[model samples]
Target: MRVITVEEHFHHPEVGPRVMDLSGPPPIDLDADFSTFWRNFTPDRELAEQLAGGRLEHMDAAGINIQVLSHGAMTPGSLDHPDATGLCRQVNDWLAEQISQYPTRFRGFATVPLYDPKAAADEMRRCIDELGFVGTLTQGTFAGLFLDDPRFEPVLAAAEELNSPLYVHPGIPPASVLRAYYSGNWPASVEFLLSSPAFGWHAEAGIHILRLILSGALDRHPGLKLLSGHWGEMVAGWLDRLDEAIGWGHYLDRPVSDYYRTQVWITPSGMYSHNQLKFFLAEVGADRIIHSEDFPYVVRTNVADFLLNADIADHEREAIAHRNAEALLRISPL
Candidate 1:
């Protein structure tokens, strides 16, 4: 079966380092597993910036026929740089060039300057219509506010109008959230992990989805396509609770779970847990589940094997592996 993984990430050669604080010193002397797995984890930065020669080889090794690349956690969209709008155009132009090199094996998700909603919407349109990008990705929050904030409606409206899916990637928490919840009681490295990949990042992403639902963004833009990774960022497991509890005082046109089922698509994002996959398959159905490796971060090369051995029917497996992504993202099948 052909495998297409979304949620694959890469770093922009120039703009990435300038905005994302990539020069921090590595943390040392911690628990072996946490330190080795996360704290000491260093991705191949050169390979991250490479496409034709480097990333394609890794994709072949892992049996991924195509990868939809997007800027990772700290995307230009989440920053407050003075030249953010120009930087976003530059980044998307670079990404479009890379995808043009191997249009079959590589696709792109545009990086928008979310700090300015109108400019972000314009960039998103240019990416989809002119550059042939599949969609746009909004990384976490902008100025500590999630997409549900009224200021972000223009981008949301553009997405609905363009029939493009918006991939919601996690981002670093606001300082207040970091200090209040993830600090104190651990080393700085541990605190950083706590605020990021360990727990906070997923929760932050999940909360944004809930806010969109409760705040009626989904209701207003009912045709919006919101994609979530990490198996819907823990929201898939709690749909029942969210619907049941929030249902009591709900004022929306539909139930919370209904919006999830209709509007949201979920990917595992390299967390290869069979139980989680099974739960999502039941909760959201196979049509809503897509495959992703979160490449260079998780780096599990046995992706084909994992999906092939999954305890699902052949049709369902096909849907998760490539069919769903092709349908949702409009990729041509091999």
Candidate 2:
């Protein structure tokens, strides 16, 4: 199978440290082995910084033919930093340079400074038109304001005009939300995990996409395409309920699920469960599904085996493996 993973990540070693630090307090739990957990789960920094040799070798070992790389944890800094315009430009330039080195084995997703809508739009244009990036990635929200906030219209407009899909990766919840909702239930370690990857992050990304639909952002920018990780950030399972509940209000031009059908795409992001594959295939169909490993952070034992052995037709497997990504991101198939 010609596998093309779209949610792989890269960290710009030189530029990462300069961004403002918004990461909240470290885990203070005394009960859980937080240190050991992170030690095992944290991605290797050297591997993340190496675009040519180390990463490529790992891909070869795992049978990944292509990786669509985007900035990882530091991605939100582009929107939070005071000098985001310059920082985002530098970040995108460096990523473009890296992709140029392994043009066929690698692809890029632009990192834009969503804090400045006009600058974000210009950078998205430059990355897609000039740098040859397939699209852009956003780490959910910036300064607690989701993209549906009217201030981000220019970025949405640019995405539509440029025909670029915005990959909505999960971002850390703001401090206030962290304190109010996710804290106090258990050990700080559990709280931290709950507020992030274990639960909060996916919920936040799902809400972000729904806000784009409900807040009229998608209606205004109808041509804009959205890519969500972790099986549409849990939205794939809830579309029916969402459409049912939102139908009571009936605010938009169509049902909430219609936007998902037309404008959204989803990837497993390393959640390689056959049950999930079966459910998502039934819920959204094969066309809306794509492939990803969520790389380094989510290193699966059976990297390619899940899709390779899916209980589906050959064409469906091919679509999830590479064809859907090729069509969505305009990547040329090998």
Q: lDDT of all the models against the reference? A: 0.86, 0.85
Candidate 2, 170-229: lDDT as tens digits: 987887887787888576677778989999989999999999999988888889999999
TM-score of each: 0.93, 0.94
In lDDT terms, how accurate is model 1? Answer: 0.86
Q: After superposition, how far is residue 253 of candidate 2 from its true place, in Å?
A: 2.2
In lDDT terms, how accurate is model 2?
Answer: 0.85
Residue 294 miss distance in model 1 (angstroms): 0.6
Q: For every candidate structure, what is the RMSD over all alpha carbons to the true structure, in angstroms? A: 3.1, 2.2
What's the residue-level lDDT of 108 in candidate 2? 91
Q: Candidate 1 at residue 236, lDDT?
A: 80
Clashing pairs in 2: none
